[model samples]
Target: MPRSLAGFTGAGYDKGRPLLVQALWLTVSTVILGRWWCPNSVRVAMLRAFGAQIGPGVLVRHGVRIHWPWKLSIGADSWVGEDVWILNLEPVNIGANTCISQGVLLCTGSHDRRSPTFEFDNAPITVGSSVWIAARATVLRGVTIGDDATVGATALVTRDVLPGAVVLAPPSADMTSPTN
Candidate 1:
Protein backbone atom coordinates (compact mmCIF):
# COMPACT_ATOMS: atom_id res chain seq x y z
CA MET A 1 0.00 0.00 0.00
CA PRO A 2 1.36 3.41 -1.02
CA ARG A 3 1.06 6.24 1.55
CA SER A 4 -0.66 9.39 0.34
CA LEU A 5 -1.50 12.71 2.01
CA ALA A 6 -4.57 13.05 -0.19
CA GLY A 7 -6.13 10.04 1.49
CA PHE A 8 -5.68 11.51 4.96
CA THR A 9 -8.87 12.63 6.63
CA GLY A 10 -9.83 13.90 10.06
CA ALA A 11 -13.41 12.68 9.90
CA GLY A 12 -13.26 11.42 13.49
CA TYR A 13 -11.76 14.63 14.84
CA ASP A 14 -14.19 17.19 16.16
CA LYS A 15 -13.44 20.00 18.56
CA GLY A 16 -17.09 20.22 19.63
CA ARG A 17 -16.99 24.01 19.26
CA PRO A 18 -17.91 26.58 16.71
CA LEU A 19 -15.25 27.70 14.24
CA LEU A 20 -15.64 31.40 15.05
CA VAL A 21 -15.34 30.82 18.77
CA GLN A 22 -12.33 28.58 18.28
CA ALA A 23 -10.68 31.11 16.01
CA LEU A 24 -11.29 33.95 18.47
CA TRP A 25 -9.84 31.93 21.31
CA LEU A 26 -6.85 30.87 19.20
CA THR A 27 -6.12 34.45 18.29
CA VAL A 28 -6.45 35.72 21.85
CA SER A 29 -4.49 32.86 23.33
CA THR A 30 -1.67 33.14 20.83
CA VAL A 31 -1.35 36.92 20.66
CA ILE A 32 -2.19 37.92 24.21
CA LEU A 33 -1.80 35.08 26.71
CA GLY A 34 0.91 33.17 24.88
CA ARG A 35 3.18 36.16 24.37
CA TRP A 36 2.44 38.74 27.07
CA TRP A 37 3.78 38.74 30.58
CA CYS A 38 0.35 38.87 32.21
CA PRO A 39 -0.39 37.86 35.76
CA ASN A 40 -1.79 34.43 36.61
CA SER A 41 -5.14 35.87 37.67
CA VAL A 42 -5.60 37.56 34.30
CA ARG A 43 -4.72 34.39 32.46
CA VAL A 44 -7.12 32.35 34.59
CA ALA A 45 -9.87 34.87 34.01
CA MET A 46 -9.30 34.83 30.28
CA LEU A 47 -9.37 31.04 30.19
CA ARG A 48 -12.56 30.97 32.26
CA ALA A 49 -14.16 33.50 29.95
CA PHE A 50 -13.46 31.17 27.05
CA GLY A 51 -15.22 28.23 28.82
CA ALA A 52 -12.34 26.57 30.61
CA GLN A 53 -13.39 25.18 34.01
CA ILE A 54 -10.54 26.61 36.04
CA GLY A 55 -10.80 26.41 39.82
CA PRO A 56 -9.68 28.90 42.47
CA GLY A 57 -6.02 29.68 43.21
CA VAL A 58 -4.73 28.05 40.04
CA LEU A 59 -1.40 29.64 39.08
CA VAL A 60 -0.54 29.76 35.38
CA ARG A 61 2.90 31.09 34.66
CA HIS A 62 4.25 32.89 31.60
CA GLY A 63 4.43 31.25 28.15
CA VAL A 64 1.84 28.60 28.98
CA ARG A 65 0.07 27.51 25.79
CA ILE A 66 -3.29 25.78 26.03
CA HIS A 67 -4.47 24.64 22.59
CA TRP A 68 -8.20 24.33 23.41
CA PRO A 69 -9.44 26.13 26.48
CA TRP A 70 -12.99 24.75 26.18
CA LYS A 71 -11.68 21.20 26.60
CA LEU A 72 -9.60 21.90 29.66
CA SER A 73 -10.38 21.75 33.40
CA ILE A 74 -7.96 22.54 36.18
CA GLY A 75 -8.75 21.99 39.83
CA ALA A 76 -8.05 24.27 42.80
CA ASP A 77 -4.58 25.46 43.78
CA SER A 78 -2.81 23.72 40.90
CA TRP A 79 0.38 25.35 39.61
CA VAL A 80 1.15 25.33 35.88
CA GLY A 81 4.68 26.52 35.33
CA GLU A 82 6.23 28.52 32.51
CA ASP A 83 6.27 27.17 28.94
CA VAL A 84 3.98 24.26 29.77
CA TRP A 85 2.05 23.26 26.66
CA ILE A 86 -1.26 21.51 27.03
CA LEU A 87 -1.91 20.29 23.47
CA ASN A 88 -5.38 19.17 24.31
CA LEU A 89 -6.99 17.91 21.12
CA GLU A 90 -9.27 16.06 23.52
CA PRO A 91 -10.22 16.87 27.11
CA VAL A 92 -7.50 17.40 29.71
CA ASN A 93 -8.57 17.08 33.36
CA ILE A 94 -6.14 18.26 36.01
CA GLY A 95 -6.91 17.58 39.64
CA ALA A 96 -6.39 19.77 42.72
CA ASN A 97 -2.99 20.73 44.13
CA THR A 98 -1.04 19.32 41.20
CA CYS A 99 2.25 20.85 40.04
CA ILE A 100 3.06 20.90 36.34
CA SER A 101 6.59 22.15 36.10
CA GLN A 102 8.24 24.22 33.40
CA GLY A 103 8.58 22.94 29.81
CA VAL A 104 6.19 20.05 30.34
CA LEU A 105 4.13 18.87 27.36
CA LEU A 106 0.77 17.24 28.00
CA CYS A 107 -0.29 16.05 24.56
CA THR A 108 -3.63 14.37 23.84
CA GLY A 109 -3.18 13.72 20.14
CA SER A 110 -1.18 11.34 17.98
CA HIS A 111 -1.00 9.84 14.53
CA ASP A 112 -1.69 6.20 13.96
CA ARG A 113 1.52 4.58 12.76
CA ARG A 114 -0.26 1.63 11.16
CA SER A 115 -2.37 3.81 8.91
CA PRO A 116 -1.20 4.44 5.36
CA THR A 117 -2.54 7.95 5.40
CA PHE A 118 -1.36 8.78 8.90
CA GLU A 119 -4.74 9.07 10.55
CA PHE A 120 -5.16 11.36 13.55
CA ASP A 121 -6.12 9.97 16.93
CA ASN A 122 -6.97 11.81 20.10
CA ALA A 123 -7.54 10.84 23.69
CA PRO A 124 -8.00 12.54 27.04
CA ILE A 125 -5.26 13.08 29.61
CA THR A 126 -6.03 12.89 33.32
CA VAL A 127 -3.72 14.10 36.08
CA GLY A 128 -4.94 13.25 39.53
CA SER A 129 -4.68 15.27 42.75
CA SER A 130 -1.29 15.98 44.31
CA VAL A 131 0.53 14.66 41.22
CA TRP A 132 3.79 16.28 40.17
CA ILE A 133 4.96 16.27 36.57
CA ALA A 134 8.50 17.54 36.65
CA ALA A 135 10.30 19.87 34.26
CA ARG A 136 10.51 19.00 30.57
CA ALA A 137 8.42 15.84 30.88
CA THR A 138 6.27 14.71 27.97
CA VAL A 139 3.01 12.98 28.81
CA LEU A 140 1.66 11.35 25.67
CA ARG A 141 -1.88 10.55 24.55
CA GLY A 142 -4.36 8.75 26.84
CA VAL A 143 -2.01 8.87 29.81
CA THR A 144 -3.33 8.99 33.39
CA ILE A 145 -1.02 10.09 36.14
CA GLY A 146 -2.64 8.92 39.32
CA ASP A 147 -2.93 10.73 42.66
CA ASP A 148 0.30 11.46 44.52
CA ALA A 149 2.36 10.15 41.57
CA THR A 150 5.62 11.88 40.66
CA VAL A 151 6.91 11.92 37.11
CA GLY A 152 10.58 12.78 37.08
CA ALA A 153 12.18 15.38 34.84
CA THR A 154 12.29 14.64 31.08
CA ALA A 155 10.33 11.42 31.46
CA LEU A 156 8.19 10.33 28.55
CA VAL A 157 5.01 8.80 29.89
CA THR A 158 3.26 6.47 27.44
CA ARG A 159 0.98 4.56 29.77
CA ASP A 160 -1.08 4.90 32.95
CA VAL A 161 0.97 5.52 36.06
CA LEU A 162 -0.32 3.80 39.15
CA PRO A 163 -1.36 5.77 42.21
CA GLY A 164 1.55 7.05 44.31
CA ALA A 165 4.10 5.69 41.82
CA VAL A 166 7.33 7.54 41.13
CA VAL A 167 8.40 7.46 37.48
CA LEU A 168 11.99 8.34 36.80
CA ALA A 169 13.64 9.22 33.52
CA PRO A 170 13.83 6.56 30.77
CA PRO A 171 10.70 5.11 32.48
CA SER A 172 12.16 1.60 32.58
CA ALA A 173 12.69 1.07 36.29
CA ASP A 174 9.58 1.04 38.41
CA MET A 175 10.71 3.16 41.33
CA THR A 176 7.71 2.28 43.41
CA SER A 177 9.78 0.33 45.96
CA PRO A 178 12.02 1.94 48.54
CA THR A 179 15.00 -0.27 47.64
CA ASN A 180 15.32 -1.31 43.99
Candidate 2:
Protein backbone atom coordinates (compact mmCIF):
# COMPACT_ATOMS: atom_id res chain seq x y z
CA MET A 1 0.00 0.00 0.00
CA PRO A 2 1.18 3.49 -0.82
CA ARG A 3 1.63 6.01 1.99
CA SER A 4 -0.43 9.17 1.94
CA LEU A 5 0.30 12.49 3.64
CA ALA A 6 -3.04 13.98 2.63
CA GLY A 7 -4.91 12.08 5.34
CA PHE A 8 -2.81 13.54 8.14
CA THR A 9 -4.71 15.95 10.35
CA GLY A 10 -3.91 17.54 13.68
CA ALA A 11 -7.57 18.14 14.44
CA GLY A 12 -7.56 16.67 17.93
CA TYR A 13 -4.20 17.97 19.08
CA ASP A 14 -4.69 20.50 21.86
CA LYS A 15 -1.81 22.93 22.10
CA GLY A 16 -2.82 24.12 25.58
CA ARG A 17 -2.24 27.79 24.66
CA PRO A 18 -3.70 29.86 21.85
CA LEU A 19 -1.83 30.69 18.62
CA LEU A 20 -1.14 34.32 19.51
CA VAL A 21 0.24 33.40 22.89
CA GLN A 22 2.38 30.68 21.35
CA ALA A 23 3.71 33.06 18.72
CA LEU A 24 4.65 35.67 21.30
CA TRP A 25 6.29 33.14 23.55
CA LEU A 26 8.19 31.63 20.64
CA THR A 27 9.54 35.01 19.65
CA VAL A 28 10.53 35.86 23.21
CA SER A 29 12.11 32.50 23.92
CA THR A 30 13.92 32.11 20.63
CA VAL A 31 15.07 35.68 20.08
CA ILE A 32 15.58 36.89 23.62
CA LEU A 33 16.09 34.01 26.02
CA GLY A 34 17.43 31.21 23.87
CA ARG A 35 19.78 33.29 21.79
CA TRP A 36 20.91 36.07 24.10
CA TRP A 37 23.15 35.52 27.07
CA CYS A 38 20.73 36.29 29.85
CA PRO A 39 20.82 35.46 33.52
CA ASN A 40 18.93 32.45 34.85
CA SER A 41 16.76 34.74 36.97
CA VAL A 42 15.59 36.59 33.89
CA ARG A 43 14.62 33.36 32.15
CA VAL A 44 12.84 32.11 35.28
CA ALA A 45 10.92 35.37 35.52
CA MET A 46 9.83 35.08 31.93
CA LEU A 47 8.72 31.50 32.46
CA ARG A 48 6.75 32.45 35.57
CA ALA A 49 5.04 35.25 33.68
CA PHE A 50 3.87 32.69 31.16
CA GLY A 51 2.28 30.47 33.88
CA ALA A 52 5.13 28.08 34.68
CA GLN A 53 5.34 26.99 38.31
CA ILE A 54 9.00 27.59 38.96
CA GLY A 55 10.34 27.33 42.46
CA PRO A 56 13.08 29.27 44.23
CA GLY A 57 16.79 28.83 43.46
CA VAL A 58 16.15 27.10 40.17
CA LEU A 59 18.85 27.77 37.58
CA VAL A 60 17.99 27.77 33.90
CA ARG A 61 21.13 28.17 31.83
CA HIS A 62 21.56 29.98 28.53
CA GLY A 63 20.30 28.47 25.23
CA VAL A 64 17.62 26.38 26.91
CA ARG A 65 14.40 25.98 24.91
CA ILE A 66 11.06 25.47 26.62
CA HIS A 67 8.14 24.74 24.32
CA TRP A 68 5.22 25.50 26.60
CA PRO A 69 5.92 27.20 29.88
CA TRP A 70 2.31 26.70 31.03
CA LYS A 71 2.82 22.95 31.05
CA LEU A 72 6.09 23.02 32.94
CA SER A 73 6.77 22.94 36.68
CA ILE A 74 10.27 22.99 38.12
CA GLY A 75 10.86 22.54 41.82
CA ALA A 76 13.34 24.30 44.09
CA ASP A 77 17.10 24.29 43.43
CA SER A 78 16.81 22.44 40.13
CA TRP A 79 19.38 23.25 37.45
CA VAL A 80 18.52 23.13 33.79
CA GLY A 81 21.77 23.38 31.86
CA GLU A 82 22.69 25.05 28.60
CA ASP A 83 21.01 23.84 25.36
CA VAL A 84 18.49 21.69 27.21
CA TRP A 85 15.28 21.32 25.24
CA ILE A 86 12.00 20.72 27.02
CA LEU A 87 9.54 19.94 24.21
CA ASN A 88 6.57 19.76 26.47
CA LEU A 89 3.41 19.11 24.51
CA GLU A 90 2.17 17.71 27.81
CA PRO A 91 3.00 18.44 31.43
CA VAL A 92 6.63 18.10 32.57
CA ASN A 93 7.36 18.07 36.30
CA ILE A 94 10.87 18.42 37.64
CA GLY A 95 11.34 17.90 41.33
CA ALA A 96 13.68 19.65 43.76
CA ASN A 97 17.47 19.61 43.40
CA THR A 98 17.41 17.99 40.01
CA CYS A 99 20.18 18.60 37.46
CA ILE A 100 19.23 18.43 33.81
CA SER A 101 22.53 18.71 32.02
CA GLN A 102 23.49 20.39 28.75
CA GLY A 103 21.94 19.25 25.45
CA VAL A 104 19.34 17.07 27.15
CA LEU A 105 16.08 16.64 25.30
CA LEU A 106 12.96 16.01 27.34
CA CYS A 107 10.33 15.28 24.73
CA THR A 108 6.70 14.76 25.71
CA GLY A 109 5.27 14.24 22.25
CA SER A 110 5.61 11.74 19.41
CA HIS A 111 3.80 10.35 16.42
CA ASP A 112 1.92 7.05 16.42
CA ARG A 113 3.36 4.98 13.64
CA ARG A 114 0.49 2.50 13.65
CA SER A 115 -2.03 5.10 12.74
CA PRO A 116 -2.53 5.58 9.02
CA THR A 117 -2.91 9.30 9.54
CA PHE A 118 0.26 9.51 11.64
CA GLU A 119 -1.53 11.05 14.54
CA PHE A 120 0.14 12.88 17.38
CA ASP A 121 0.61 11.18 20.74
CA ASN A 122 1.58 12.95 23.92
CA ALA A 123 2.29 12.10 27.55
CA PRO A 124 3.73 13.71 30.68
CA ILE A 125 7.29 13.38 31.97
CA THR A 126 8.25 13.39 35.63
CA VAL A 127 11.73 13.85 37.07
CA GLY A 128 11.98 13.22 40.77
CA SER A 129 14.09 14.97 43.38
CA SER A 130 17.88 14.97 43.04
CA VAL A 131 17.74 13.30 39.67
CA TRP A 132 20.63 13.94 37.26
CA ILE A 133 20.18 13.69 33.53
CA ALA A 134 23.56 14.14 31.87
CA ALA A 135 24.51 15.89 28.65
CA ARG A 136 22.90 14.92 25.32
CA ALA A 137 20.45 12.51 26.95
CA THR A 138 17.01 12.09 25.45
CA VAL A 139 14.06 11.29 27.70
CA LEU A 140 11.04 10.11 25.77
CA ARG A 141 7.37 10.68 26.53
CA GLY A 142 5.76 9.23 29.69
CA VAL A 143 9.09 8.22 31.24
CA THR A 144 9.53 8.87 34.93
CA ILE A 145 12.97 9.26 36.42
CA GLY A 146 12.74 8.38 40.09
CA ASP A 147 14.37 10.26 42.95
CA ASP A 148 18.17 10.26 43.10
CA ALA A 149 18.43 8.55 39.74
CA THR A 150 21.26 9.37 37.32
CA VAL A 151 21.10 9.17 33.57
CA GLY A 152 24.49 9.13 31.88
CA ALA A 153 25.60 11.20 28.93
CA THR A 154 24.02 10.50 25.51
CA ALA A 155 21.65 7.91 26.97
CA LEU A 156 18.20 7.31 25.61
CA VAL A 157 15.56 6.70 28.27
CA THR A 158 12.43 4.95 27.04
CA ARG A 159 11.01 3.55 30.27
CA ASP A 160 10.63 4.33 33.96
CA VAL A 161 13.81 4.51 36.03
CA LEU A 162 13.75 3.24 39.59
CA PRO A 163 14.86 5.35 42.53
CA GLY A 164 18.63 5.70 42.91
CA ALA A 165 19.18 3.76 39.71
CA VAL A 166 21.83 4.75 37.19
CA VAL A 167 21.03 4.56 33.50
CA LEU A 168 24.09 4.49 31.27
CA ALA A 169 22.31 3.92 28.00
CA PRO A 170 19.37 2.19 26.39
CA PRO A 171 18.49 -1.31 27.66
CA SER A 172 20.72 -3.33 25.38
CA ALA A 173 23.88 -5.46 25.26
CA ASP A 174 25.98 -2.32 25.58
CA MET A 175 24.90 -2.13 29.23
CA THR A 176 27.10 -3.93 31.74
CA SER A 177 25.79 -7.09 33.38
CA PRO A 178 24.80 -6.94 37.05
CA THR A 179 27.35 -8.61 39.32
CA ASN A 180 26.12 -11.40 41.54
For residue 95, model 2's alpha carbon misses the true position, in angstroms, by 0.4
Tell me the spans in candidate 2 whose CA falls farther than 4 Å from its real position.
170-180
Q: lDDT by residue for model 1 over 96-170, one digit each (tens)?
A: 999999999999999887788989978999999999999999999999999999999999999999999999896
Alpha-carbon TM-score of each model against the true structure: 0.92, 0.91
- Model 1 regions lying over 4 Å from their true place: 171-180
Question: lDDT score, residue 126, model 1?
Answer: 99
| Local distance difference test values of all predictions, in order | 0.92, 0.93
Clashing pairs in 1: none
